[model samples]
Target: MDMQSGTVEEALDKAAAVGVTAVVQVGCDLERSRWAAEVAGRHENVHATVALHPNEAPRIRREEGPGALDAALDEIAALAALPQVRGVGETGLDYFRTGADGIEAQTYSFRRHLRIAKEVGKALVIHDRDAHQDVLRVLREEGAPGTVVFHCFSGDAAMAEECAAAGYYMSFAGNVTFKSAQPLRDALAVAPLDLLLVETDAPFLTPAPYRGRPNAPYLIPVTLRAMAAVKGVDEDELATAVAANTARAFGCPPPR
Candidate 1:
């Protein structure tokens, strides 16, 4: 909701009315992470994940000097310990946006976030974009946390199977509904029902019919329905599975 025009409270209200039992708002930087934590604190149905995004890593290193990235990681580690913080992420590799010059910093930041997630005993939410092999390599090397979720999963069936084998959760976002995303849909089909999740990734990746407009939690049903169709399952069944999977992924009980 931070990306949208309305207040967090209003977003929560709309989400609840539309059958969204809970929402996990992720932070891409220290300031936004704090804001997410504050929002989570104010709403029972909301939770947060704190991290420094891969793209943000290089910028911080360049703008704030070399050691500044370490300082920011320390702050992220501290935030991960908060009760309202359920995960440490939107971290991981993003070679598409970070470029070769930033890869080193991104890798370092990703490793630190992974350690923090394990240390805090929280879920690790990853954002792998065009750097899947490196992301998997780091996870294998460092050993992933008890719960790992690839948020906005952008991989093929083989990759989905690999993640499933590693016991990772694959979260499909609104992009899954796009006609050009048949490969993503194929991956969704191969993903085990027990390991499936759906997200809005709003106010971005809005589902079709409303693709160009701003997205919010209430629009999750649009993505969920699309996923269910791709998986050849009833919408309600998929909804139930997603709820259970989400709770498991975040290491939290489903909201009453």
Candidate 2:
């Protein structure tokens, strides 16, 4: 919402007008992480997460070297300690965007993020794209944090079952409504309601019938409605469950 709307205030206002009570503004790098923390601090309805994106691993390694990557992780750790920063994330494996040579750096960065989240007692937000197996492997190898959320969950039923068994939250985005996303809906069907969450992935994955247009927290209802349909539950019931699940996952109460 901050990236798409005129200002953070405007985004929050718009979201509220459309029934959005709270939002977690995620950051992909140090600069954005700082911005997110600042936003969360000023807005009672907002929280933030800090981490370097998986695709950024190669660039950081190429331009600044491994030492710079370590330094950036250190900065991310510091930012993650902020009171409003409730998670360490947007980190995980992205084989689709990162090449083979960059996998090592990406894995290393992910491990550091896991450690930071654990140290700070925050949730772990994972961005797994075409690397589910590797992501799971790394989390297992490093020992996952108490709360783990798969942001814009892209796994199938089996993977959903695996994550559910491990008590990880699966946050569905607008992509789940795509006509080509039956498999995602299948995963949602099997996902435990207690561990299900909904997000906009705003300004990126707009729901069908509104795809290619800008997305914001206000548009979350569209995704939530679809999820409710998939789960065979009332929209309001699912919303309530997801709200509680989100608060539990991020360790924050809903906005009043």
Candidate 3:
């Protein structure tokens, strides 16, 4: 139920068949980060964003040792410097999964990831969940990088406006198509076209009517169509804007 159905090549081929040509493979740990970079290097249309998941930071400190987290961060920084590594993240707070005990470590890891992104002159991809204000505060305290994307953005309209004001990209995922996601729709409605992006957040958050199915890049069109409706724009127009916005957000060239 958790694993996706096919090989990476198959998924990419299917995605291309459906007009989802480019992808940013995200890594939430050291091993996956290395793999992501390798995959990106192998595939012209794929780019990588590497980071310790917010939850991973606290777990590493608690289980591995205090220094283990920093060592991991150092490796992530190195990976970020690679040409195929377009960003540093999926880093940021995740209060929903991490308890009060883990907050300090999570914040520290997030700040370091921020520094790495800036140092490498790359974009910062945030994975904020139920810690939106704190995530905003941290970015403000650390000074955000040239580009910041709130991956799988879960904020409401007011938050969207704030993000827009700060020139942050809010990337909507398949969950936005859910019937109960009116607030997400509201956020989408207010989000500027230039700041909008779409993602699969694969093997999770499958779009409506396919919620229980394993998600993949091929399903992006479903979410895009829903977002277009919420945004009150023609689907093709929204698609064009999103394609350009994604390239700008990740600092990657648009796919051919």
TM-score between model 2 and native: 0.98
Q: Worst ten-residue run, lDDT, model 2?
A: 1-10
Order candidates by lDDT, high to low.
Answer: 3, 2, 1
- Model 3 regions more than 4 Å off: 1-5
**RMSD vs true structure, all candidates:** 0.9, 0.9, 1.5
Give one digit per residue, the lDDT tens place, for model 1 in 1-256: 6644788878888888989979999999888898888888888788999999889899999999879999999999999999999999989999887779999999989999999999999999999999989999999999998999999999999999999999999999999989899999999999999999999888899999798888889899989999999999999999999999988888778978
Tens digits of per-residue lDDT for model 3, 75-189: 9999999999999988999999889999999999999999999999999999999999999999999999999999999999999999999999999999999889999999999
How would you encode candidate 2's per-residue C-alpha lDDT over 85-171 as one tens digit per residue? 999989999999778999998998999999999999999999999999989999999999999999999999999999999999999
TM for every model, in the order presented, reads 0.98, 0.98, 0.98
List candidate 2 stretches off by more than 4 Å: none
